[model samples]
Target chain A: MDKPKKSALIQKDGVSISEITNKNSIENLKNKRKSEMDPNELVDSILNKDITALSRAITLIESKNPKHLKAANTILKGCLPHANKSVRIGITGIPGVGKSSFIETFGNHLTKLGKRVAVLAIDPSSSVSRGSILGDKTRMEDLVKNDNAYIRPSASGDSLGGVARKTRETITLCEAAGFNIIIIETVGVGQSETTVHSMVDFFLLLKLAGAGDELQGIKRGIIEMADLIAINKADGDNLKAAKLAKTEFTRALHLYPKKSSNWNPKVTVCSATENTGIDKIWSMVLDYVEITTKNAYFIKKRNEQNKYWLLQTIETQLKFYFFNQPKIKKELKNQLQLIENNKTTPFAAADYLLNL
Target chain B: MDKPKKSALIQKDGVSISEITNKNSIENLKNKRKSEMDPNELVDSILNKDITALSRAITLIESKNPKHLKAANTILKGCLPHANKSVRIGITGIPGVGKSSFIETFGNHLTKLGKRVAVLAIDPSSSVSRGSILGDKTRMEDLVKNDNAYIRPSASGDSLGGVARKTRETITLCEAAGFNIIIIETVGVGQSETTVHSMVDFFLLLKLAGAGDELQGIKRGIIEMADLIAINKADGDNLKAAKLAKTEFTRALHLYPKKSSNWNPKVTVCSATENTGIDKIWSMVLDYVEITTKNAYFIKKRNEQNKYWLLQTIETQLKFYFFNQPKIKKELKNQLQLIENNKTTPFAAADYLLNL
Candidate 1:
């Protein structure tokens, strides 16, 4: 395919040229085998801001094979030195809250400011749904077509912890590829919002106006985790109601004790469909970064999060190690049944399992 | 000391006759020695509503010696058949929120209604302070004098897990002793609130009226966890402000999505000092129990909490086992330092530790 025609055809489907290259590279990877591969070669490409290499590294990280995981870890170690440069933000909202349009407008706004934006997502529901949610490029059409932006959906068919670790490493790869603004998006369903929130500097909760006191299906825990809440669709007939919702949320936010970071959560009104108040949200994020950095909370929070993930990773692995053993699994099931019957205390059962 | 004077003298300190009897029994136990005593004899005494034996069993559970642990476990297994009969309530507030006075008043109210009451506390701070907080019976004078009431402070000098397990076991012992209503008190300073909340049927958050915007230092997370929030010290000069605080909290609670229990959290005003609204708070708790039992959430939530605690106990043990190993601890310390230096990703450090 000719370059312009290929670009036009791919744009019709909202798939980026980089995504297409990633697909071709996967095919090339199998045929090329192990002969011509150098891990550092890919690392150098990624550090040199090569989008194709970054996407390929992410694909490897998402792979379930042990060999791929080894390669992924090696590349991740290489990329670590180049990471933490981007302002990572997490965006989440219930369905029908205009998350896709908001992300597109926000990405475009960032690109217009001469910042490269990379969008990623964490949807562990792909296995149950048999398809990824954000994986559909047709949703974020404008940003997909923007040469200055790159978007990838959730890595499917793995445990939630597996995907979270993969996404965390993918952030490093994107940062190495020179994406100055990285957006991690999650649907406000299940625990994905928490996963995304832990990995981001700023967490934005998008809400719709006039849910009529039901919180529009947003989980209370998610709202509590938000650093900022934007009432979306604040234009045309919805403008007044959105403004009212903003005030209501502001009052609700006041009930919370001040955060340890000393950053009070802000509520604002926005209409992503009309591209209104998009810059204001970005500025809010910038303000958060500046203030937190000044107070040293930015670095402190990141280090703490790093330590948390370290302990979390170890716990997950240890659980996997014990759980995967046939003898332990059989014993665990019996002990669990006893616990269900109230025949054994949990501590006693744990002691039994440890002995086993 | 004769029985009546000993009881009256201990009552002045708010210590129950049962506590005094338990102290005497400990001396008798030393003279009798282990070989002459049967664990089932104590279990039978507990089952027969012998408060002294119940307190002694709890002391055994809280002991660190393996021999005592074995005896405690034996008594717990015997008592398990008679447990789960009581309504467990958790009450928390920052210091000076009058938790002790509220519980005393509430306990007296329950006992007046001819219900057996047990008050326990999970003060993890006792060790740090080198003195127990709620362990001071002088604070709960009225309930300590009530023949139908039993109170115990947190078991000091153990890990939080050890304390939680002991408290949970103590609940069984209390229920076996025919105490039908259990109140667990925790200072809202740390994670003890969550631990207490998890084991209780209802969680009540106590706040003060005139703390201005501080919410009496109760955490937003704790408020969110509450089934009921009571503004204490709502008497005389604080009455109007307490009512206003009640309105503010009701509005704040409205912003959160309805809890899965289908029960909306309530905010009420009460004065522990004046002993007003004590009956109302007990009525609210009873109402919660009635509704949840009718809807079957009462049983369902208990089952879920049981399963949750089981998993939590296992995880805590696994972490302890791995972290306690001398070689792993040394290696983990080095890897953590590297993570702090940003020279290693958490996942990478986790992998190294797992390999070790």
Candidate 2:
């Protein structure tokens, strides 16, 4: 409850907050959160379905501040026992494919079915520049305004993938808070698709009718990972084109062997604007769950993904830390400049940096 | 020089018997204009313009054995002073695009122009399965039969790109042996393509006609790196298609902003089988050298590539050595298994192994 008392207690438990906090401002934020209650108490509040505590817990988990990591780790431990209850779905699509519109329509449909839907949408417009693209919550006002749905725009930080990691931890936090269904609508298409795919149970790839060869231009690796490919915007004149695209997609999809071994990828047509075929998509997703769960592949896959995320996280952090080392930073920059000047090369610069 | 004296002198210089033996074999095979001598003495005898010593030096450089590496390195140091004065040309295409046919026509044309040409090709074949797709030298019997042209297939032990590295080092040896042009051929589609690209002064991408929209499927990154995209197999009815592909390729090349400051990728049509446009292609390559050389970008890029190869070599060797440390190998394998089975992550496994 008190600052020094809590600090002492935290220190006694071998988490002195030194490894988690560096700057005064971050420490103040952590201390403020600590003053409100014990770290375990906040976690307990989250378990009671307190959305505010759940959100705060996620922020703690995501913080770069040294002191927060220890607290966040403990919070994660507390939340783990209460997590993994909800169905998690990942939605990815290229730009201008109406991803926001689809998520809003689909979120409304879920709420209408008497399910509490939480949308962990990662769209950081300010951080990542976009042109001719929809990348904000304003585009999904209907869903954001809904009582049963919670939509959070991406928080600014490192990679969109890093943002996705926080969103994933938040998904667990939300799941522990008894959210029935979690939808992680990626920023768009391939960039965040792989990151989002590593954490969710079902992956949905959205496409417009006229994608044509552009689909191949986008990564084949992501397309191969997709569980379902939905030709979005299947309303009006687009319907004919959507059906044609669906056939083309079916042809392309045949090239990839069945991904899940026990499950076959499905191709579907939907009009997100009209909110038609949303229920069918949900039903199909549940069918996947049914099959994968029966084969015990669901947990096995999630565990694999968790390990992948952990490795990716550590690799990224170590690389960042290694590059930022005082002894390496300036010399590394110099070597990079040498490479840019064609005096050395990217491989040589990497070697020099790592060896140093 | 007798065997015992030569052996004593070579041993004193810290050179292995195998290095001397490999070089001696090449000496014995040489159709000399002058006198016959002991193969061991022949290597030291032809210090001025010895194609045989050059061949043996390349053989040592290509060997995977540690002793071979040391001996090759020493030989390379010795050859460096008299290394290649030739322009290195790397040609890549997918399988069945007539690489051999193209090289045969091109090399013969060079030999007719009174230039001694060397055709060093890398075929992705294994020694265990020794038969090469283009094993029969009769495919290029014209070039092979030419006294002015030397043809060597990829050696049996290593990867294609590896064969290229060996060939590159050998190119220096060949140039010293008075071969003015070195052509390294591979499919533009494999990992070998990029590897070959880094080692050569010019990278030529050969494409087939009627590639159509399939051309779009080729990776933009790889395409952007090409200095020339030749619409090969441009004979017969395919001529119209080839011309069309050339136009399309030119258009695609325009879409890419100028790369490497000076190089603007050129699009041309050629038929390796018809022997048409082959000479023109060579002239275009000469023009490229003329332009890039006047601008000094040629040798600059080569210097950068040298640094890259050095760094790449070091990094790979470091990774191999670190992972193979006798005490840590078992633990590393165990951790890798745990990572594969989802018990831990690759990052953690790496960290654990490093600590161990």
Candidate 3:
């Protein structure tokens, strides 16, 4: 039970174990310093399609440190010009709807078509659950190993606004890193889908066929935001149900007013496990791109989205500043209590807090 | 074309024309002063159910002047304890869905039941169009003439938030005036429906039977918000279509997850013009109330709504304070331009403006 002597763990080259360990620590420090490139160098590396540098820039963007934020902004400024070239697609579905599998199949298809694909996620719940949708790359075994594909898990943050901001900036970094196709994935349970919808050019909603209850459990307004609905798990006996779902969804989609892009949202049946209908989904996305581009809605929508983000950022920051103030924070709780007790109206409570 | 002699024009009573004009002016001034009572007097009159005082209090709440705001807050604080006693219902339909007729018939029915009804509208477009949904009360001729019913035009403001706040405060004033049934009406074409939805105890969506397109042109998420969907104009040849719509909507409603109230949303056909089925609609509302009250979701929802309003008001004010700043006003345009040119990301632009 006695501890082994340090020399007993020495290397075959006859160097002492402690000396080798010290050498390894210095080497690790050197590697860390090398990876912490200056903003200009990081931008240059990203422009050269260096995935390491791209990931580093995103880390900086998501960092809470003021210093990292300054560097992230500098890198963003450098990357901005090259950012909007990619076709950003958003994929969303409720849990167990095969989002990861569909993304894997769709992303691999894109890479096979000579497109560099980058996948990112926005999971606001990850900050609470400490587990993200794409946190395990093994979920997409093939795409994770594809040289032309890069996958990044959802950014952890206290708010969807914060996570969305990081993911949006990460899109720019990925696009600047020569990823021609960016896929933003989110679980279809909350405000994250809307956030993703606002940032992407095309939105795909994945669904699973139920027992004649295809629309149940779907988030409200999500179908309206969809550019396409793909019914997944359409293999074997599920094919009949999937086709039924497609028909139902197609009829339902017609109920919505025509989208601004003038593209009718399509509902199709797909099976990610069998890889059937994956190619058709790609073709539909391209069709959308072509129609929107021909009608000039592609650029118009992007410009509108940019403006939306600008306003949204300002508003979120304004609320954050107001709510985070020590006095306002304390008074807000008191005012809410007063509101609950009917001692004050919400309007009066608001006025008092604003004055304070 | 000769002008009449001034004394001849004015004096059936043997008074000088100038003296009569001055007397009339003084009388009008005295009446105006009488109507513009102090906050305490206004509160007392509102509590006494003086309609004129309630109207004046609402006008004060809708005023933009700081002095009037102070007075309005005082009146609201006085009225807070007496509020929350009414069944606040929100009614929404597209422009041609017979909202006025429906409200008119419904309000008349409520009055027949000895319930004091107060009708208010939230039309954000009124500020721009200079025409409000309820500004012309003639649409509801009978309700306007009903002694127990009070109808107020949509409050005009530059923003929906501002108009909504005014309407919310007016609800307190109305409840204080002993109105037991408060109906907030909004056009379903915009965000006004969502605003109205937040403040109401029950939401009612009015729809028209279409030619096999029951859900077309309906606002997204409107169906999910409804406690009851009343298909109006269900008379003459439209009765069959209305029934069909009710069936379709009932099936569609089933697709939505059950609501927190545990009461299923009902769909029915009603004829506002004939006043048929109005009683059934009211009964459905009462059923909803009974169920929600028993389950305690009625009080819980109201408390959540109050908190929602308080937070909404604070956030709206925060944005107002930020966007109204001279520096931000000038720089926001610059930032938007930069965003358009792809020279800056929204996050970076936001950070720059926030630091300022």
Q: What is the TM-score of each candidate against the true structure?
A: 0.78, 0.75, 0.82
Candidate 1 accuracy as TM-score:
0.78
- For model 3, residues A119-199, the per-residue Cα lDDT tens digits are 999886987886898998889988987889999999988778888888998999999999999999998876888999999
Candidate 1 stretches greater than 4 Å from native: A1-39, A127-133, A207-270, A274-276, A287-296, A336-343, B1-41, B65-67, B92-102, B124-133, B157-159, B187-190, B202-303, B337-344
In the order shown, the candidates' DockQ scores are 0.35, 0.11, 0.44
User: Against the true structure, whose TM-score is highest?
Assistant: 3
Q: Considering the two chains of model 3, state its CAPRI-style docking category.
A: acceptable
User: With candidate 1 superimposed using the best TM-score fit, by how many Å does residue B344's alpha carbon deviate from the native?
Assistant: 4.2
Model 1: per-residue Cα lDDT over A164-216, one tens digit each: 88788889889988998999988887778888988998999999888943456
Model 2 lDDT, residue B183, Cα:
85
Candidate 3 collision pairs: none
Residues A1-356 of candidate 2 have per-residue lDDT tens digits of 45544334433455554322244456467657665556798788877876656667777877878888678767766766677778889888776788888988998988998888888766545235522123356787777667677675555456765576677777777777778789877645445667777778998988888865444345566667788999999999889999998898787777665666478888999998887778889899989999999999998887677667654654455455555668876786687566455444344355566676
Against the native chain B, what TM-score does each candidate's chain B reach?
Answer: 0.88, 0.80, 0.88
Q: How close is candidate 2 to the true structure, as a TM-score?
A: 0.75
What proportion of the true contacts does each candidate reproduce? 0.57, 0.07, 0.80
